[model samples]
Target chain A: MLEEAGLAPNVERKMRLDRLQRQPEVVGEILKEHVERQQQTEGLTLRKLSPGVKAMIWFLRLYVVFMTVVVVVNVVQTVHP
Target chain B: MAVQDVGRENAARALDRTRVDNARKNRKKIWLLWLLIGPGILVMLGENDAPSMLSYSATGSQFGIGFFLPFVLLTFAMAYIAQEITVRLGAVSKTGHAELIYRRFGRFWGNFAMLDLLFTNLLTLVTEFVGVVAGAGYFGIPAGWAVFGAIVLIGVSYTFRRYWTWERVVMILSLSNLVFIPIAIMAHPSWGAIGHSLITFGPLPGGWNSNTIIIMLSDIGATITPWMLFFQQGAVSDKGLSIKDLTHGRIDTALGAFLAAVAAMACIIATAPLYIHHMNASQFGTAQFAQALVPYVGHVGGALFALGILEAGLVAATAIATSSAYAYGEVRRQAHSLNRNFKEAKSFYAVLFAALVVTGGIVAIPHFPLEYVVLIVNVIAVLTMPPAIGFLLLLINDKEVVGEYRNTWFLNVLGIGVGVFVSLAGLLYAMTIIFPNWQL
Candidate 1:
């Protein structure tokens, strides 16, 4: 679980165990919350985007390409002319 | 605890402890706000970069204080709309923008976004050094020393190895960007005319043409760009803001927008004297603008203007370099926190300083056509923003990511509106370039 949270397990285990001995319920609650947050961070997957969303993304991609060409042409004309 | 965990946890715990104490004691919210107001303010002022101030200066010198006063304000509003989403995304998901994009969109599309960001950021960073060099030239400082000084000053802030310390030190330096405000006051602009211009949005002296479209696009780019989204989200996540801090986060972003808008407008007002004198300053460089303003604003004000440009460039270079580092670290799954020491995050520091060194070196090359880079850097930023905004909107609306903190309907409308406006502005710029004779 500590590894999944991107934490060093060996280091975390000793510290968490020390805290658990002093405050069992509090430590358990903190551990549960931390694990949940870690799951949220790691569980993200590629979203199944809608068709309209997909088209919009494609349009924006092509728009960038078109603009890049325009900018290059503009630069060439201004610099050379 | 492990050393890495200790360093990260200690800084974050300091703030988290304060927050808990404030709630428990029923203390004033103002103290809590002061703690949460770094990223938003940093991103906003950082965007008021050297080229951006020069763009605003160009607006005033050419068009006087007419249409652009309000137009600049609107762009910040658009910036606010787009940036606010990042705050929520960071606070809720605790993931940086680059990582979120790669996770949800897959690496194929993510690389494209990264390419666009890095390309625009590199060009913009070069212009920043150009500003630093030009500003230093006003005081007869050599370009080599100026670039070296900027790199060292930026590097010094990182030595603290704490996000809060870096943010506070840079925030103090970024406030120097407001030096334009006093310079504007010294320019003695007509208050009545300024009021009338804001109300009417006109007397746009030359009317709409290719030059006007370029400036408008540049102005939009100045406020809202891809780097801002990445930087702010990374800062928020690294600062360890949670969903409970969302209200403070929004306040932080709004305050940033307000302060940046004021500085941007002050820049235009400070340079309007050139227009009043009928001086053609359309081709003036950063130092040239300062020198030309001396007759109207006097020697001290001119110095202030030059210093403002220098601060703008320096503050922005720090932020932009860190943003690139953040993005790189996020994608590589490496230690990326400012809270982490240099040894713990070697690649992060290397990327940050490497970007600064390379861009600064480019500006030091004699007669490298730095002006052209300054002129088009903002334009290129705007052109590349639509796709960045698209990805941003996608992630913000992804229920799996932001969960219950997803954008509201009204927020989505505003977000989409900003995207459409940016796209249309880019399209108009292309139209002007394609058909030089075209006029609006």
Candidate 2:
């Protein structure tokens, strides 16, 4: 299957950029959004969401919970039946 | 190694040369961007796994070439909508979904999410191996030999230690999924009926029956699942995709969805003969399916169908195993890029191979309740998808992570729409299972 997927060359040169990643200026451009997120969400909580977003989240959560129960019950029936 | 190093490295080279080389450098970077196409295509096609093909097979055998012919197309559209966000998220945030959840949602919810992924991934992995074994059996191969052969093939790619090579290799193999199209044509299905089915709702035998809904959920599960989100996000991040690659990533994903959807519909159309002739194939394994289809599609078509199943399993096992590895790397903060040699990222490769070995080995074991695993795998996948989609939307919309790249109003509407559709399918499926004899 691996043979069937095919291959490419020059990968070694292009595959990893570890050496240049050590430069702060380079790293910032690459991960600036990610780092900013880590700092902003340092103590993030559900309560921080706007009320409208919070309601939507809760509604989606309710559907998930209800489906979980239904699936468990279905699995039990299948195993028993 | 981080991907942005290329940008930094390219700049330094330009400074060494004359300032007039900026345009040439920019062109080179654009060419490099094209190399980032593997993950999006791999993950999207990889979603068309063994059990998913089986679900499509069942859909064809049950509903023939009617209602589901177009329904499957719509499901892929939904998959495109949901997966497009992951591409943008990975490009902008440069983090795996699990790690993002761990950092932003707290460990409590992250652990819950991880548990969901682990359970479903393992179950789904086993089904892929089941497909490998069953399809190989059609050629009179033993299950153990088939499983062992698959492990070797899937394992060989990881040893390459470069995501570019591995992704290209998977891409090449994934192309075999198209074999089903020819097989479908060999059956000589009426093109007029097929076109009419798409234009009209469906022939839809036994309209909205319990079995119909169950099959619908299975089709939904086949197209959209929790692992898809995790797998694509991890692949995008690992491939070192950047904001510049977002357009290509979306194109790659769209192309994959189109190919996979075509392959899936072909599987259904090929099996439609069984339904028309009343072959009673609801209990079929892959080998049984091929044997049953021999009369309709000819011996060659039948053989290709079996080959499609095997290919599906082989491709999916590698993709699914990698998803687990990516998740493990994110949550544990271990080295995870496919670009790393085993010595550099032992745990990541170990987890990936471990998942493959355990799942593949389980299928080889005698009397291991393989039927039970196959039965609930797709169903359970859909049932657990709501939370995955919920988390996906929340992560994509979070301003802190994606910054100015957060979802637009249209995307939010589409994302929520997919979540609701999946949830409804699961709910309807559960109703049918709980009240099996209801003549609704």
Candidate 3:
């Protein structure tokens, strides 16, 4: 996956593991899921996501939804009014 | 196990070959810099799109060569601060901005990022074509022919099927943005005043009003935008930058920033005559500005200004469309590199061409609020920028992602300063729009 992304594979391996260890707070939450998935032979891909990520993404969607609605109404009122 | 061993052997062999090639290439320092120059220069010049030039023109006509002369320069500096981080992030991750955000942050967040990019890219792409059509209109070119020619010209870059070739072609097209410098020179401004306004931030003929704030934010939007973050990072990854290329990356960004700043300032200086003549700000479009300038800078200079706007639109359309294509490919885990042939990256190329065609068509529609879109696009771009910056700072500071290449303390201060500036400006813009009578 790293090579396909055009990253030097060996260097990527070291970089990923190093980052995982240094940022332990996030490691268990994000990296460990990838590790276990890899161990299960699922192959390394972008499909995997943790619960925390899922929650954050939903929050963003809701936020954009609200902002879009407000901006649309405001623009219409201003333009057409 | 055998496959791992074979892969390692192949990689090692490739690495040795690369080292030899690098040694040979490094012998010509200037040539090496040229090769590393694409992404930064492209993003910076690309940001100087049609609406941006108009905003700069409006700045000149409204405020003259006063406060905005220096302010534009400062905004570009902030742009460099923000974009420099993208260079490091892309080089370190070997992944586009969307992919890295999705990988580290997850799918749901990726969806939001994708949405923001798609929404803004589409809007910005439309304005670019609007510029193209309007600028070409100056030469009596029909909108259909101009849009068609623009799509074709932009498509030529994609046909090269390699990032290097595409970068070189786009860089050549982008360099035409320099035409404004000659137009500025043609205007024959007071050199002392130009230097004085730049250093003193000059007086605001109409001081600190809502319109002033709007123009300031618009100018800021033109300089350091959200598309810039996505496009530059994607280009760096597409160009296959590694951490070792960091210095070249910084130089590429700084050089681009300087050129873009100069081009923006030139537009303002060239149009300062409109302010001196006291033309209404509402009356200044590409054609109007060019027509008004004929009496001042002569016919050739006005024609060149129109051509510069055309080039800006053409260059920015290509870059903005690619940003959308990059986001699409990254989120879906498809083949996304410019190195891939059409058949190999069908979805990638399709998305890119589709964006150009759709946006280009939209700009061709009569009385389609192209003016309204142009007016609102840059400001809205600034409005949607904070989240992009938030994601950027997170990824760049991701120790595992950029590793040792993450921003240092000084860089962090600068990056956050840019973020704060954008957020504050966005807030003020929002408040002004909402209230419509708030004093700044």
lDDT of 3 by residue, A1-81 (tens): 223333342343244322323333333232232233223322224444458645654554554465455456556865898
C-alpha lDDT of residue B286 in model 3: 84
Across all candidates, the chain A TM-score values are 0.55, 0.43, 0.40
Q: Scoring model 1 with DockQ, what do you get?
A: 0.23
Candidate 3's error at B313, in angstroms?
A: 0.5
Per-candidate DockQ vs. reference: 0.23, 0.18, 0.05
lDDT of 3 by residue, B1-440 (tens): 11121122123222322332354355757756765678999999999999899899888888888899999999999999989998987766656788788877777677778878888889989999989888999999999999999998888778866677788899988999999999999999889999899788887886877788879888998997778988998898777565557799999999999999999999999999888888886656788888888998999998999999999999999999898888889888887767677887899999999999999999888889777788878877776776777778767876666667787888888887887788788667667667777886
Indicate the docking level reached by candidate 1: acceptable
Q: Residues B1-440, candidate 1, lDDT per residue (tens digit)?
A: 12123344343433343343344346657767877789999999999999999999999999899999999999999999999999998888877999999999889889999999999999999999999999999999999999999999999999987788899999889988889999999999999988998899978987898999998998998899999999999998887776767888999999999999999999999999999999999899999999999999999999999999999999999999999999999999998989777898999999999999999999999889887898889999999999999999888888888778888899889999999999999999999999988888
**Model 2 over residues B1-440: C-alpha lDDT tens digits?**
23343343232221211111222345665545455467767877788888999999998998899999999999999999989999987877777889888877777778878888898999999999999998899899999999999999999987776776788899899889888899889989989989999999699987988778878888988999888889998887776565766788898899899999999999999999989898887788788888899999989988898899999999999999999999999999887888777887899999999999999989988999887788778888887788888889888888877778888999899998999889878777767766787666
- In terms of lDDT, the poorest run of 10 residues in model 2 chain B is B12-21
Work out how many backbone clashes candidate 1 has: 0
Best by DockQ: 1
lDDT of 1 by residue, A32-64 (tens): 333355468788788887899889989999999
Tell me the spans in candidate 1 whose CA falls farther than 4 Å from its real position.
Answer: A1-35, B1-24
